[model samples]
Target: MAGNFKMLAKTFYGFEPILAKELRDLGAGHVKEGVRNVTFEGDTGFMYKANLCLRTALKIFKPIATFKVLNEKELYQNVNRINWPKYFDCGKTFAIDTTMHSDVFNNSLFVSQKVKDALVDKFRAVERQRPNVNTHDPDVRINVHLYKNFCSVSLDSSGSSLHQRGYRIATNIAPINEVLAAGLLLSSGWDGETDFMDPMCGSGTFLIEAGMIACNIPANINRENYAFMHWNDYDDELHNKIVDASLNKTREFHYKIIGYDKAPSAVRKAQENVDNANLSEYISIERKDFFRTEKPIDAKLHMVFNPPYGERLQIDVEDFYSKIGDTLKQQYPDTNAWLITSNLEALKYVGLRPSRKIKTYNGKLESRLVKYEMYAGSKKAKFNPDGQEAKS
Candidate 1:
């Protein structure tokens, strides 16, 4: 049955295009990018594939209904009008999460409460049984998005964020989100053909994701559960088939992935995470200060890392960044280094002109993913401190 339905994949800012491209590649139809979200059409199997393969998506939402509501009363009525029994049984536990961008709705909690009441009433009115609300770990999670007078009700297919790929159990003070790290690496055109390094690898997230991307491994291969698995319409056989098919597409990677951290604790944590991801064969971690180390590989090296931004790690911001610049300029030749940091003022101390800078966010702090390319050989790399190219 080719039942076409709309689904929205939510992602961090600056990742909608990547998410949309992922959906398109995964056999989705009518792929369209929106603000921090990508909407697409796919059948049930395709939905499972998207939840498993997408590297940048945080959540995949299957919107069951959309309507216009001027006030809470209308919202309650419309929520009750939905065929809730079609999605789940009354014995299952569910949760309602609400987001509002309307002036009329002052409280999202209130909206969620109303929607829950509507659902409970609908189920109880017919079968004399109602689904209990379990906020922490629900069998089914529902999303209600209200933009002005419009409301879209969706069922979350990806549970607890796809960033929780069920591999990383250890982390440092400022561990990067797995999805964000993967997206940043993809944005930098990492195909895993060359040697990859994360000089400040906190917990080896980039290394693991890079290995997965190189080997064509599904992003959520290690994940044990998703919200869709608990739905009444979930097809276990279809999901297993999708998993096997995706596994069949796995390819071999030839290059090495390495991680370096000055802190011994960070190194240990990274190694533990790498082992958990079962990527120890492709990745190596060392407890060495990036500033004191030279480029390990003579060939073109691709580096992506989230260095200390002074806020998380207690290090001198200006001097630390200056050391980073000195290390890269003196020791790291024939390399392209990419790093994300929230400290704009500290970035100036690096004294090297970033050839490329993309605006991104690390949580609430606005940051930039900057790139410095050191040409391989006697050709000296150019550094424009002002970010403008200087005439020869």
Candidate 2:
């Protein structure tokens, strides 16, 4: 507890509780949930572990300093007082990102500029040379969040977004974010309990993430770097030990994880990504239109996918949705299918009343994760096409 510091893990909206649960499970102390973020206590080593292991976190930030500032001068002074030399060297590159909800700082760029100036000034004063600022790819990334009069300065432990899982080399036009993919799968209560399928598997994110969850694999086992590796106090041996320990905890998964994509390119990309993630043993990708393929496995199948939303892909939204519904209703019996889309108007064409519909945001678009339950065998079922019960 002596070295433990408060940390925040940023996430998407409606994912705070899920992230909090993850932090608590990973032995974080005093875990608390905020809007689109979760705060917890951990040490430097745990920071590295969190960056490596957390599946739902977009970024992990370690707050180095907090202060009260009413104006720009105070902001600069507060940031300058920190011991910058203790964090990185003058030869290292750095970048600053700022977010503010305060009236004092009108522009986030100005705040970032001030923080950068303070850091460069400190380095110049001590070593006579400042760390070069590299906004594109920095050795160190700093985050400043100003709310009202409170300013919090944090070092970004995850250099890039955790969504860059190091496995996805090929992507389709509208590939889903890895964090969102993992979160959506978890939200659907997918613990690899049974056979899993992604009917419209683009890039196979869901299939790979599901395999990792099923096997208890570390989320970033394939990732080669983290921002903490550049820190002065980073312990390579300790980090390696943590990696070994996390890998040792991996469990056996005995269920089938399959993916199908209509586009041949998508299937190729998905297969390539699955191989890159080292999950080829657990997953299989096929080039077949979901509407034309029948259920491969007879056992209970859990499905999650994002079809062409008509936003970019030129397709008849209503007819495509109707075909999806027809495929599920006629072919995919004994399955719980879940899909997410921003096209609310076209959702009606699905025909089946969603058992559950939850409003969520995918980036700036308002989206819904809807679920439909198709019972197994001999059970007479009918889809309501009157469009009466489908609620937003």
Candidate 3:
């Protein structure tokens, strides 16, 4: 515990608990959930493990400095006082991202510029050179958080957002975010016990994530890089050992994971992405219309998917939703179907009452993740007010 330090794992809204549970399960100390982030204590090895194993985390940050600042001058002085050379060398390029929730700083971009100037000035004064700023792709990324009169500076351990798992080489027009997909699966209580499916599996994001969750595979097993690798104190041998240990802990999953997409191009892309993730054996993608298909398995099925919200994919909103309800009620019984949709007005057209409705956001669009439970037998299945099996 001597080398352990506090770290924050940022996530999407409603995912704090999931991320906290993941950290605690991975042996993190002092785990606490806050809004869209979770803070915990871990050593360097654990940090590596967190980056590799956290399915719901968007990014991981190691806070290096926290101080009080009243104005831009104090911010510049405090930021410049830190030993910038200790983190990374002048040869490495760096970028600063600032987020401010304060009355003092009106523009976050200005704060970022000031922080960047301070860091560059410090490096120039000491080493006679400064790291270049690369906003697009930086070797090192620093995060600045300002609230009221306090500032928190952190070093980003995960470079590109962890959602970019590096396995999704091919994506459809509206592929679901990997973190969101995993969170939805976890929220649905999907522990790989029953058969899993995504009827509208655009790029197989849900199928692949479900497979990983089932098999206890590290979420970023296919990811090849992290910002920590470029840090000054990074230990390659330790990182490799951590990776090996995580890989060795992967358990075997023996349930079927299937995906279906009506479009041939989506089917091809989903298969390609699944293959890229090395999970083709666990997941199978078929080019078939979900409305025309019955349950692929006779046993209980757990379904999670992101159907078109009528924005990207054009369709008759009410008719499509009604078809979804009809298909599940009449054809695909014994299934717990969960879907996220931004079209709240259209959700009423689904006919079946949702057992659960959770508030969530999908890229600025406030959405609801709803669940419809279909019983095994026709007599047992719940029907709408119309008293019809498959209502129009």
Candidate 4:
């Protein structure tokens, strides 16, 4: 059994608090949040569990070494000192990735090359052979982070991004990233207590992620592989136990999760993804323009989705957003509607003052997750009847 060690879970911008909370809830000790990341103390089993269950983390890194270095030669010497053979053998295909914020290193690619040379040299000297470099798909991934004069090396526990939850077989145009979808849902305070919806659900990512959250399903239940499985200290039995334990924690969801898409192709893709996730029992998809469809149920509804950003879709940005506001105001009452969009210029046309405007990102586009509280009657949108944003 491995002793407890400090690890970092990297997340998207503005999700550091969410990831930190998730880590703490999952029994991580000494949890602390950083910029787009959270550091915590956990043992090997906890590592497996974090990778298996965390919905917002893009990757989990187990730091092995930290060194002070001012020059490339020092960097090489420090990287060569690590006992690489104890982590992974020379036969394992590996890749070195670098991230830095330092005047000492200007080119990250060059830094990666230098680190790779040092690692390969160490292996060759010890075993008379070296691992092959596999950039596309590697059995082992080593990360080097340089901040100022300090360089930290870590082993990427999650092979691919945890967002690749292995259930999305089909994707519509501009399908939201799975991790982002889950984070947005969680940030919206979605707990599966009431009916849920994604009116413009693209490929059903929100629906599936919402279902998983509602039922307490592990976010990566369908994922079959991780980078930790290839390490020399991989423990299959412990990993199996972790998976089983997580599965046992899933609770039954009594509410409904519905998705609506106007496009037939998107509807098919969302259905395919839902089936792949084995969540068809909890989620249903329909083909209908959201502006034309009313709320699916008469209960309190929780809604989250990413609409066409006008970046890719050739729609009237103002009219589309206005229609969204109109639908929420007229069609969906007693609903908490949240949508993420990068078109800040167009968001003004919604004519409704969002109660909460959280800063987030959709890929490279800086976006906002705005919330529209549609009460049953007079407490609805803040839009004036003559189509003007009401004074706060």
Candidate 5:
């Protein structure tokens, strides 16, 4: 508790609660959920752990300054007042990202330009040299957020978004994001209690993430980079200690994580990704159409997948969803199936009303994560047309 500071973990929409729970479980203090982010208290070592372990976090930011700004001049002066040289060296490349939700600034780009000018001017006046801007891949990333005239400037600790978990080397046409996959699994209450399956696993993101969660493995175990690594006060020894501590917490997972893909190419790519993540021991991939195969295990199964939303894949959306419903009803008994899709109209054809429908986003497209329950014996004996259970 010597150097405890507040940190914010950004996540996708509707993932605030799940991300908050993840932070709390990781021993964060005073964890609070915001719109699409979570705020918590942690020290420098904990920050490294959060960056390396939080599966739902997009980026972890350490806020250095907060103020009320009435105009552009005030923003520049306030940002310039901070000791920019203390955070990073002049030789390191940096990038400024601005997000505005206020009428005071019509263009976010203009705000970013002003902030950059202030930072560079501060560095030039103090250190006699300015850090060059590298928008493509920066060593340092700064975030400026404005909401209703209030400005919060933070230093981004995680670069390139935490979704780039480094395990997914091969990608399919529209592979689900690793963060999104992990969030969905957590949202579905997956605790490694039973066997897991991703019937239409593309690039095996869900399988890899599920395996990590099951085994308590650090989310970024395969990741090699973080913006904090370029900071002036980066302590390699502290970071390594944190990594070893997290690795020491790893537990054994007894269940299987299975993936199936109809396309041979997708199966190969998913297997490659699984191997890349070093999860091949827990996850097994096969080239088999999900609709044609019954449940591989008789015990209760947990399923989460992103079926082709008919975006890049050539298929009849309505018929495909119908077959999905039919197959789940006819084959996969005693299973809980969840899928996310942006095609709402096509989703209606699934016939079985979802027991739960959560509004979420897949990238920029608004989507729904729905759950369908398959009974063990007779499907009609338990589920009604409305997705509710039938009376005894």
Candidate 6:
């Protein structure tokens, strides 16, 4: 606890609690869940581990300064007070990202511009040289957040986004984000206890993420870049040590992790991604129509997928959803099926009541992650006299 400091992990709307649990499990202190983010205390090594191990985090930030401001001048002065030269060199390009929810500052762009000016001004006054702004792809990313009259400035430790896990070299037309896929799998209570599946896998995002989770593998193990790596005080030896320590924590996965995509191209891409992640040993990708296929094995299966919502793929909504319902009820016995879709009206045509319905968002559209429990033989007779689920 000598050098432990507060850090924040940014996540999706319904994933704060999951991220908080991840932080706590990773030995973080003072873990607290906030809206779309989780705050915790850790040292520099812990920061590296958090960025590498956290599955649901989009970005990890280290707060540098916090102050109260009412206007642009106050914001500029407060930002300028920080020692910018100590964080990154002037040779490295930097970018400022500002998010504001205040009456005084109405425009986020204006706020970012002011902050950028302050940073460049301070560097020029002290070092006589300014770090050029690289909005496209900056080596250093600075985060500015304003709530009411309070402003907090932090260094974005993770560049781009943690969802770019580096294993997914190939992708389909409408591929699900890696972080969202991982969050959905975690939300569905997948623990590698049973056979896992994604009937509508696109580019194998869910399958790879599922395999990684099932094996206790780090989320960003394949990733080679981070904003912190570009900082002046970055410790390569400590980072490598953390990486090795995290890798040593991985456990074996016995059950199968399978994926299905009807499209031939999707199957190839998914297989390519699975191999890229070195998860081919634990996962299988096949080109098969899910509606025409039954469960691969005679065991309880954990299923999660994101089917078309009648928006992109031209298909009959009613017929497709009805077929999905019929297949699960008639073929997939002793299984827990979960799917997320924005087509709420189409979801009703499935004709099966969801055991659990959770409100979630997919990118910008509102969606629901619903679960359907398929019994072995009959709903009332879930267990036979032998205390086992009756199989047809």
Instruction: Kindly indicate the candidate among 5 and 6 with the higher TM-score.
Output: 6
**For residues 1-392, what per-residue lDDT tens digits would candidate 5 score against the true structure?**
24899999999999999999889989999999999999999999999999999999999999999999999999999999999988999999999999889869989999999999999999999999899999999999999999998999999999899999999999988989999999999999888989999999988999999999999999999999999999988999999999999999999999899999988999999999999999889999999999899999988999999988887787899899999999998889899999999999888999898999999999999999999998778444667889998863
Model 3, C-alpha of 345: deviation from truth (Å): 1.4
lDDT, candidate 2, equals: 0.90
Please provide, for model 1 over 1-392, each residue's C-alpha lDDT reduced to its tens digit, 9 standing for 90 to 100. 25989999999999888888888888899999999999999898999999999999999999988999988899989999998988889878899999889867989999999999999999988778998999999999999999988999999999789999989999888889999998999989999889999998888899999999999899999999999998888999999999999999999888889899888998999899889988999999999989889989878899998988889688899899999999888888888999999999988999899999999899999999999988675234455898775543
Number of clashing pairs per prediction, in order:
0, 0, 0, 0, 0, 0
Please give the lDDT score at residue 247 for candidate 2: 94
lDDT of each: 0.90, 0.90, 0.92, 0.93, 0.93, 0.93
lDDT tens readout by residue for model 4, 128-239: 9999999999999999999999999999999888999999999976989999999999999999999999999989999999999999999999999999999999999999
Q: Cα RMSD (Å) per model?
A: 4.4, 4.5, 3.4, 3.8, 3.9, 3.2
Candidate 6: misplaced stretches above 4 Å? 378-392
Clash total of candidate 6: 0
Candidate 4: where is the Cα deviation over 4 Å? 378-392
Report the Cα lDDT for candidate 6.
0.93
Model 5 segments more than 4 A misplaced = 379-392
lDDT tens digits by residue: candidate 6, 303-370: 99999998777789999999999888877888899999999998899989999998888998899999
- Per-prediction TM-score: 0.95, 0.95, 0.96, 0.95, 0.95, 0.95
Candidate 2 local lDDT, 37-123, one digit each (tens)? 999999977888899899899999999899999988998899999999998888789999898899687899989999989888888
- lDDT score at residue 91, model 5, on the 0-100 scale: 94
What is candidate 6's CA lDDT for residue 23? 92
